[model samples]
Structure formats: C-alpha cells, structure tokens
Target: MDPLHAWKDDFRREVEEVLAARARLRTDEKSAPEEGFGGRIADLVIPPAGVYADLREAVAKLKVAQDEAAELRGRFDAKDRALEREREARERLKDSVSRLVLALREERAGRVEAQAEAKKARAEAEAAAAALAEARFDADHAAAKAEDWEREAMARLRGAREAQAQLDRLMLESDAARAEINSLTARLEATACRAAEDGQRAEEAARKRDAAQAAERAASARLAALEDESRAQLARCESLERANQRLAADRAVEAERLVSEALVRAEHEARERAKSAYEDGIEAARQRVEAAERALRESRAAEAEAAQKARQAISALADFRDRTHAAMDRLGERTRAEREQAEADIAAARRGEAQAAARLAAEQARRDAALEEERASLRAQFEDARAQVEEESDAERRVMRERWQEQVQALEALRRGFERGKP
Candidate 1:
C-alpha cells in the first residue's frame, strides 16, 4: 500500500472519530431529568404530619455546601472563561472546553440538589420527632386519666360495698328476729291449750267432791297439782324469754361479722378490678411510648444516613472538581507547549526559506508539509483524548446518579413501611 493512502486513511479515521465525538458531546450536554430531594423527603413523611424530625445537622450541612458551591462555581466560571479564550484558536479544543464547562455546571447543579435533598430529609426527621413527642405526651395524659378514673371507681366501689354489706346484715338480723317471734307465738299457743285442759279437769274434780269428802280431798290434791304445774309453766316462759334475748344478741353479733366479711370480700374484688384496669391502661400507654420511641430512633437513623449520603456526594463532587481543575491545568500546559513549538517551527521554516529561497525552497516546503501533518496528527489525538475523557466522566456521573437514586428510593420506602407499622 502507498504511504499517502495510509496517511489519508488515518486522517479519514480521525475525522470520523471527531464527528462521533461531536455527537457524544451534544448528547452529554442534554440535561437528564432532575429528581430532587424534596420528593424523596415527602415520600418519607406520612400524609397527616406537615413536618417533623431534627434538621440542625442537615441544615448546617446544606448552608455550608451552598456557600462552598457558590465559591466553587465562581472559581470554575472564571477558569472556564480563561480556558475558552485560550482554546479559541483550536476548533476541536473549543468543543472540549465547552463540554467541560457544561459538565462542570451539571456537577454543581447535582451537588446543590443533593444538599437540598439532605435539608428536606432533615425537615422530615424533625416532623417525625415532633409527631413522636406528641404521641408520648398524649399517651402519658391518657394513662394519667385512666389512673384517675380507676381511683375514683375504686372509691365508689368501696362505698357501694359498705352499703351492700350493711343492708345484708340488716336483712339477716330481721330474719333472725322473725324466727324468734314465730317460736314465741307457738309456745304461747301451747301454754294456753294446756291451761284450758287443766281448768276442765278442776271443774270435774269439784263436781265429784260435792258428792263425798274423799272426793273433796282428791279435788284439793288435784288443785294443788294444777297450781304447781301453772307455776312451772310460768317459770318456763320466763326462761324462754331470757333464752330469746340471748339468741337475739348472738344473732346480732353473727350478722355484723358476716357483713364485715362480705364487705371485705367485695372491697378486695373491687380493688382488684380497678387495679387491673389501671394496669391495662398503663401497659397500653407503655407500648405506645415504646413504639413512638422506636419510630423516632428509626427516623433519626434514616436522617443521619441521608446526611451521610449527602456528604459523600459533596465529597465526590469536590474530587471531581479537583480532577477537572487538574485536567484544565494539564490542558493549559499542553496548549502552552504547543504554542511555543508552533512558534519555533514557524521561526525555523522562515529561517530556512530566508537562508536559501532557490537552493533550500524544496526542503523547506517538505519540512513545512511534514510539520503541518504532524500538527494535524497531534490535534486528532488531543480531540480523541478529550472526547474519551468527556464520555468516561459522563458515564461515571450517570452511574453514580442511578446508584444514589436507588439507595434513596429504597431508604424512603423502608421508612414509610416502618411508619405504617407503628400503631
């Protein structure tokens, strides 16, 4: 193959690469859809709460980041303008600078967005903390109310039990008194019947005594026996009255004791019930407190994680910015060296032509042609390298963005799920 053909082929290949690079640069300049931290933070919070959670750390970070970003952006812009002017002479290099500027702007915008997102996350955390605190306060208040209600109920129950016991004792005593009255009535009826029979016998004995003296003596003996029996019945009635009084006293004492026992039992049962209700209320409140505490802890953890992610993003942005500056510095050095070499070549060519226009003109023309070809080759290489760098940087940025999105979405989802589970 001819060397001219080979050189033409190489030049043609470089032109194709440059065209491809132009297309890629255009694509990279197109902005991707912006997913802000606000949306993610909104997803973290529930609908009922407007805002909660601690935000001091995230807010501080955002403030610092915003200030830093402004500084970096100003520096980047100044540097970019200088580079743009310096690269204006080279068509391929101009495109690279333009692409680098666009990339820098995108990186700054991404960093700003990440910092804003962290601030939003902090707001959500604050909202959650406020919600948890409110829950705890409400729970404590409810528990206190329940305890008060339990105490009041217990007091009422005590009074009711006392009243019920008094009533029970009175009923028992009344029943005992009624029983004693019935026994006394029956005994009186029996005594009256006996007295009637004895009177009838006395009447018969007197009739027989009227017939004879012996009958009269027998009637007297019968009268004496009847009198003795009357006395005995009277003594028995007195003894029965004494016995009834003693039984009444005993029944009263027993009834009082029974009432006391019943009252004690009732009081114990009531106390137990009140205590149980109070305990249940306390337990429920405790569970709510525990749940709220757990949620608060989780929200704190998520916020901290988001802050950490934001910090990492900022750190990565810083690193990228440093690399871009280093690349710009190296590009500046290259441009300077290229300018000096071109000046030297121009000087050497001029010297060659001036020294021998007739004898050295062909050699000088050949040297000029070789220098032009070498410059073309170098330009092609530089364009290719710059394009490759732009493509690699864009790819890395896209991958990092996707990873951050996935992680944020996952964390927000988990936080929502946990909140829903809380009572």
Candidate 2:
C-alpha cells in the first residue's frame, strides 16, 4: 500500500483502539454489580440492564468518530491537490519571467550596437568635410599664383615698347648721304628691325598672358565648381551626420524604453511572485487552522464521551446503591421482626419454667415436712418402746436414739442436694 494510505489506516486503527478501550471501561463500570450479586439476583438488583447497552453506545460513537475522520482526510486530500496546482502555477510563472528577461537582454544589446554604428558614421562625415576644405584651399592658392605671373608679363612688354620708340627717333634724325650715313642707316634699320621683332615678341607675350588669364579664369571656375561640389558633399555629410544623430537619439530612446519596460515587467513579476507566496502562506495557514480545529473537535468529542460515560457510570452506581440500600432496609426490618418474635417466645417459655419450678419446690417442701413428722413419730414411738424396754436394758435404748439422729441428718442433706439439681 502507499505510505499515506498506510499511515491513514494506522491512525484509524489507533482511534478505534482508543474507542474500544473506552468502551471496555464503560462495560466494566456497567457490569460491576453482577460480580457482587449472583447472576439471578443481579438481574433483579442491578440497574442499567447490562454491559451490552453501554457497549452499543460506545460503538455508535466510534462509528461517528470514524466517519468524521474520513471526512477530514478527504478535505486534506483536496488541500493537497490545491497546493500541487499552486506549485505548478508558480513554476510556469517563473519560466515566463526567465524568457522575458532574456528577451530584454537581447534588446539592450541591439540598442548598444545601433548607438556604436551611429558614432562611427558621424566620425566618417567629419573626416570627409575636412578633406573637401583642404582641396578648396589648394585651388585658391593656384589661382593667386596665376594672377601674379600675368602682371609681371604686362610690365615687361611696356618697357620693351618704350625702348623701341627711342630707337625710331634716332633712325629718322640720321644723314641720308655718304658711306657713314649709309652705315648709320644700316645700323638704324637693324635697330628698327630688332625693335619690331621685340614688339612682336611683346605682343605674343601679351597673347600668352591673355591665354594665362583665361586659363586662370577657367581654373577659378573649376575651383568654384569644386568648392560648390565640396559644399554639396559637406551638406550631404552634415545631413548624414544629422541622420546619425537622430538615429542615435532614437536608439537611445528605444533603449531607455526597453529598460523601463524590463523594469516594469520585473516589478510586475515580483509582485506576482510575492502574491503567490502570500497566497501559499495563507493556504498553509488555513490548512493548519483546519487541522487545529479538527483536533479541537476530536478533543471535545472525547471529553463529551468521557463525561457521558462517567455520568452513566455514576447513574448506574447510584441505582445500584439505592437498590442495595432498599435490600438492606428490608433485611433490617425482617431481622427486627424476627428478634421481637424470638424475644416473645423466650419470655413465655421462661414464665412456664418459673411456674413449674415453683410447683416442684412446694411439693418438695411438703414431702420434706411429712418425712420430718414421720421421722419424729418413729422416734417418739421408739422412745416410748425404749422406755418400756428400759426396764429390761439401758444400753439398747441409747443405741436406738443415736441411729435415729443420723437418719434425720442424711435426709436433710439429700433434700438440699435435690433442690440444687432441680434448676
């Protein structure tokens, strides 16, 4: 059998045994008078019928107790089932809490990753803007160098024109006659030719300066375009940086939300756990209270049973005592009557014996008187005879008198002895 069942059976048996013992005590109390009086007289003399009635009552009480115990056991079994269900519920709740915690942790990690990525993107945008600004500075420096070269070339061309004008005046002022003049003219012509070539070179240089200015202007335009592209790129970078900042802010807010949610969930779970524990404690306390109540009921039942048995025993004893007292009263009355009759009979017999003794005494006295008179007459006669014989013999007369005196003394002793024997 299961251990719980075995324990229950053992407890039930113990209760039965206790009840049986109480019953036996009650039976003994009920039957006590039967031992003093023999069976026949006991039936008429003792009260409460027999031990069977008391035993029946005790058996009935035992049955009631057994039924109550069975009911309590059933209630306890139901409580056990409720406790088991609560335990299962607690386990399920704990598992759910564990999963929520794990999910919260994963969300926190994701939020951190998003934040790191946002920082990295902002750093890249700053670096790109710096490179664009350095490129714009290099373009501006190259345009300034081109402007300086154009100014220097124009100054050199102006100086070369002034020298050529002076050489033309000298050639016009020279004489037109002779070898010297011709030689001077040849020199002037050469000078003029050289000055014209210098002028042409200066014009070519001015053309080149114009081309350099155009190139510088083109470079400035390219630089401006580059600056505009850089500005656009910087703007795009700034937009991306703003986006990263916004994303970081959003992720921070999301992380904070997750943390707050996790905290709220944990608080809710804690409250649930505390509530469950409180309920469990209350259930346990209720079971304890129920058990205590059962125990109190059993104790009260036992006390009531004991009191009932005691009352019954006291009643039986009182009845038995009353019967004994009645019997004793009847016996005392009979003894008194018998003693009175015996006293009366003894008084009558004593009167009769007294009367008979008085008559016998009177007869004995008359007989004694007659015997004394006869004895006196015989003596007197013998004395007279003696007187007559005295004339013949004195010795014979003396002997006869002495014999008569002894005969009288013996008769008196016999009479006294007979009076003593009669009573």
Candidate 3:
C-alpha cells in the first residue's frame, strides 16, 4: 500500500476541525488544471465515478491512432498524481472525523452522568424537608438548561457526522430522548406554578377538611394521582437510557464495516494497475521477437543467385564432354579411311606389273622366229652358187684336154721347139 493511503482514523473530528477540512475540498487534485476541461468541470460540479473515466473519453474523441495513444499515456501519469493526493486527503479527513465522533461520545457520557446526579439530588432533597423547596427549584433550573443544550448538541452532531458513517438511526433516537425529557420538564414546571397559585385556597380547604369527613377523602385522592404521574415519567427516562446504550454498540459495528470496505477497494485497484503494466511488457517482447525473425530471413535472401551459378557450371561441363567425344569419333573415322585407300593402291600396283611382263614375253617370241627364217634363206643361196662354179670349171677343162692333145702333138713339136729355144 502507498504510505499515505495506509492511514485510518478511529472516529470523526470536532465540529470546527471538520469545517476546516471541508474548506480544503476546493483545492483537491481532482480539480487540477492538467486534467481535461470536462473532467475538471465534472469534479467541481459533481462526484466522480472512476479515476480514469474522463481520460477514456478524451481518447475516444481522437481521429488519429498515434494521438490517442499519446493522450492515454499522459492521462495515466496524471491519474497517478491524483491517487497520491487522494491518499493524503483521506488520511486527514479520517483524523478530523475521528475527533468529531469522540466528541459526540463525550457529550453522551456527560448527559448520562448529569441525569444520575439529578436523581441523587432529588432523593436527598426529599429526605431533608428543611431545604426541599430550594433544592427542587435548583434541580428544575439545571434540568431545563440540560434539555436545551442537548437539543443543540444533537443537531450539530447530525451535521458533523456525514454519510461516512451508519450511526444515523442512533442520532435520531437520541433526538427523541431529548424531546421526551423536555416534555417531562414542562409538565413538572406547570404543576409547580399551579400549586403556588392555589396555596391560599389549600389552607382554607384544610380548615374545612378538619370540620368534615368528605373533604379529607378528596385530599387523599389528589395526592394519589400526583404520585402515579411522577412514576410514569421516571419509567420513560430509564427506557431512554437503555436505548442510548444499544445505539453505542451499533456505532462500533458500523465503524468496523467502513474500515474493512476501504481496505478491500484499495487492494483491488492495486491489482488492476499491476496487470496493466504486465500486459504492456508482453507487447514489447512480442515486437522484439518479430524483428529477430525478419533479420534471419534477410540473411539468407541470396540463395537463388548461388543456385543459378551452380546450374551454369554444370551445363558448361556437359557441353565440354560432348565436344571431346565428337573429336575422338572424327579422328577414328579419318584413320580408317586412310588405311583403306593404302590397300587399294597396293593392289593396283601389282596388276600393272603383271601386264608389263606379258608384253615383254610376246616381243621376245617374235624376234626369235624372224631370226630362224633369215638363216635358212641365206644357206640355200650359198649352195646353188657353189654347183654352178664346179660345172663351169669342168667344161673349161674339157676344152683344155682337147686342146692339150692337139697341143701335145703340137707341144712335142713346141717342146722340141722350146727346148730348142731354151738351149
């Protein structure tokens, strides 16, 4: 609990003290300038319902959300200050009220003691006949004054004790007791005035009563009536005293109820304030948590770029592999074509060598046949020329033989002649 709010008073203050506290009401914080115009006016013109009701009204009128929030913050701060001032006022008012309640109690005690003293005085005066008249007169004067003061005191008590307490019924009963005492005192005074006025008559009647039995009987009857009236008044006074005691008890119970209610209201308000603060803290924590989640999302925002680069690298690698495979296939095909062309060239060279060898063998056969035919013709011509030469030589020899025979005859003759010529 706040220190100021913890204070409580046992009873109300005296009348003058209550008047002073009432004077301070105009300067209470509920009417402070910081509050809205409508709120301040209401506090001045009427009682408040709740502390923040006017602030809530102000928030409802704002069109912008930000302005509404700002106004609410300002109002909350003002309410805290108002609460502090309320605590101080409550403490001061309780002190003033406590004193007032105590004064009322003191007044009641004085009245009860006064009544008892008057009763004792009456008994004493009746016992001493010498001062009876003087004592009765003095007692009646004191009773008259007490009754008048009682009336005034009860009226003041009503005004001093506001609805802050529940002892109203007790006050009303007190007023009734005061009125009953006033009526009883008026009857006693009137009886005394009548008795003094009839004193001469009473003496004359006494002389007549001695002279007659009927007169003495009437005097006894009048005395009896006066005693009965006195007894009735005494009974009424005792009943008033009992009622006063019962009202005192009821006042005690009412005071206890008032204190307990104040404590309960204070506790409830404190709990509500704490709950509002906790809710504001939870909202701040939630905003921080959302910011953290957003930061985490932003950190990994480039995943698509990295994935695209990886795909490009994979495509390039596949294209390089395809190009390498195509080059190898082309190299293998060119090598096979070169080998086939070399084999075809070798076969053509062998066929060309065989045709050249066949031509050379035919030309050698023709040259050998021509040489055999030329050799046979030259041998036949040489044999024919040799026979002709031999025949011609034999015919020459025949002519020579004839000539030689003749010439032998002639040679003998010529030999003789040559011998003769050589010799």
Model 3: lowest-lDDT 10 consecutive positions: 2-11
lDDT by residue (tens digit), candidate 2, 348-387: 7557656765675576567557655655665565456435
The Cα local distance difference test for each model comes to 0.49, 0.49, 0.43
lDDT of 3 at 69: 33
lDDT of 2 at 201: 58
Residue 109's C-alpha lDDT in candidate 1?
46
Alpha-carbon lDDT of model 2: 0.49
Comparing 2 and 3 on lDDT, the stronger one: 2
Q: Over all chains combined, what TM-score does candidate 2 have? A: 0.30
Position 351, candidate 3: lDDT: 58
**Model 1 error, position 287 (Å):** 3.4
Clashing pairs in 2: none
Model 1 whole-model lDDT (C-alpha atoms)? 0.49
